[model samples]
Target: MRSALIAGTLLLAIIATIFFDEVRSLECYVCSRQEGNAEKCLTTTKTCESDENACQSEIRWGSTPYWSQGAEKQYYVTKKCAKKEDCEEYVNRFTSSCQRIWYEDWKCGECCQGDRCNYYIIMGAGNLKATWLLSLVTAVVIFRHIFAS
Candidate 1:
């Protein structure tokens, strides 16, 4: 009877791990159209949706408006988490020369895999956490089974 209970508990734990993966989220910088003179953007973290797995950044440059007398150029930057399909589509669309309109100039976009890649913060420790958790869970189950038997 005790063994059955232990087995059931282990099964539940495994099921929980699988279910958790479906709801797993990635952290991303979510901002657009921010204005600042600083080259690095001040960012806020967001929990990305399940479909959004890639980090993305965009930079755009535009000619000065005719109404403006200043010789300054216009620039915009954005960062966010994006869906893989959308990222591919964006690459296909923007890989060529930047689009130009009467007043608008060319824009550049980039996509990267892994967490916070768009921000250039590279660390694989987060991925190891799940492995650690599963290992701990497995060890616990084995220990419990040995003692219970």
Candidate 2:
């Protein structure tokens, strides 16, 4: 019984370590339009208007407006590009350039330039750590039970 208890405690400790280690945050780039006109494209003032009803809505998630702040009123839009390569591709594909900015945690930032800019934010960590830790603990428990007996 003492041996079993010790083994279980060790197993739990190991599982906990792995669980914490695997619980890393993941960042994704988000862009949004600033609350100003085109002439002030250099301004970095913007805010994310979250709509619980439209969390999954496919509307513009970034600050780039549909219409240009310039003549002809052509609209410029922002898209979420996870990878740097993807961001570059977006700029190239859309015939528009973008400034990439890094953001920590899950908080959103305002637009920086051209009524829009790239910002990074945490999306979700999921159950990866828990799953890994559980598997490890189960394996350790089985090994100890079989070998000790």
Best by lDDT: 1
What is the C-alpha local distance difference test score of candidate 2? 0.35
Instruction: Show pairs that collide, candidate 1.
Output: none
Model 2 stretches astray by more than 4 angstroms: 26-142, 145-147
lDDT against the true structure, each candidate: 0.63, 0.35
Per-candidate TM vs. native?
A: 0.54, 0.24
Residue-wise lDDT of candidate 2 within 17-38, one digit each (tens)?
6655434322222333323223
Residues forming the 10-long window of minimal summed lDDT in candidate 1: 120-129
With candidate 2 superimposed using the best TM-score fit, by how many Å does residue 52's alpha carbon deviate from the native? Answer: 22
- Give, for candidate 2, the lowest lDDT window spanning 10 residues: 51-60
